[model samples]
Target: MDLFQPSPSAHPGPELPELLPLGPDGIVVRFGRVVSPQLSAAVLAFEQAVQENLPDGVTEVAPSLSSVLVRFDPARGRRDQVLTALRKLLGGVDWLAETLPPASRIWHVPVCFGADQAPDLKTFCQLAGLSSEQAIAQITQTPLRVLAIGFAPGQPYLGYLPPAWDIPRRAALTPQVPAGALVAALRQLVLFNHASPTGWFQIGETAFRPFQRDRTVPFALKSGDSVQFHAIGSAEYSALKNRSDGLGGARYEAGA
Candidate 1:
């Protein structure tokens, strides 16, 4: 059985997407309470639509796990007007049935697992009832879609892992995991953008720096991108770490 499913009933209201006010400068168009692939598709679709037919004075449109945050200049755009425009757009389409937009890029990130880089791998494998080899195979076998980029700069929340990988967060935090740490919990993977403590288990480590201010395009990954984490040897990982390009031995193809 699947461990998680969409729970539209979690909120008591109309089944349609909800538009909630986000301060004077922004509004949130929430699709549903749960974070599912379908809802993500809807959110992205709406995000694309808003970008295509941008409202007057609207400055930014960002998609979260289940919502699209539309920000505007309060001086140029009134809250009521933006809300009305958003409501009309929301009502015009069956967003939930909309197909996911094509990914902008697909990344193949090389990672070194079950060594010093992945300090929590043994425990994570134990929780999933899989041996280290088995765990690695399952994780590397499939490319996870980038659900939403948040919680940190350029950090990508990738999911949904198979049923056996639907593990929960650890009861306590792991003091700190380095930037490029591949952590997992709640059937999702979060590629850390910087060294930070987390409740998620550190399953692997990649040299890919998702956020690098020095580069022309600082954020390496974006929402709707796909990531394939291929296993690499410790030596190869070390080599990638020393390179100056900052991609960490990862390459991408356009229009994934």
Candidate 2:
């Protein structure tokens, strides 16, 4: 027997999600208008469910900060049929109550937050009304969650800093921040996976490379993972930077 019978007209319940079509073969299931842990959890749960019990014709499922993007094989399934299947799947679960997907790890990343390593540290401290040591202490003391991966390949958006640390992006963009640059803004921190322009305040730099194209697993971190940043000195940073193995002296623990 089929796991689920397709309804002639799929109607979403009170907690119904908004289904927005993307191009011809994609659909975005938006859980809420804003980003939150609950929304992220819901999106990830729905993403996992879709990946595990994909209806006919779905090709890929990608989770975002607050939504899931499902791609379909147009030749194999009509849009309406896919939508019906997705609606049924969405209605089947209590999204808000869903737990985060497993295999989440805690990564201890070594960062050099000295003035030479972090060009914007002074500015960041000025804005946050903290001394350099205080700023570093505040950042390093907290373990941040991997909220979403975007902006660059393997670049993770980690966050939920205390309200006092909720700083805004710079008015102008820095020409470019190299890979492994630790930047922060709006209560979230982003470790740059590759050189890119950014408006976020560059607070530190890590030798750890999260994105290794040649490696079997290109991305070292995933959404729902925890990241704890620890301060390191120039000598250690240089030593780790010279190593060719490519993990950049970062350590990982299985459970978060």
Model 1: residue 87 alpha-carbon error in angstroms: 1.9
Question: Which lDDT tens digits does candidate 1 get at residues 41-144?
Answer: 89888888898889988999988889999999988988777876776676647889888887778889999994799899999889899899988887898778
lDDT at 2, model 1:
21
List pairs with backbone clashes in candidate 1: none
**Predicted model with the maximum lDDT:** 1
Worst 10 residues of 2 by lDDT: 1-10
- After superposition, the stretches of candidate 2 with alpha carbons farther than 4 Å from their true spots are 1-13, 92-103
| Model 1 ranges with Cα > 4 A deviation | 1-14
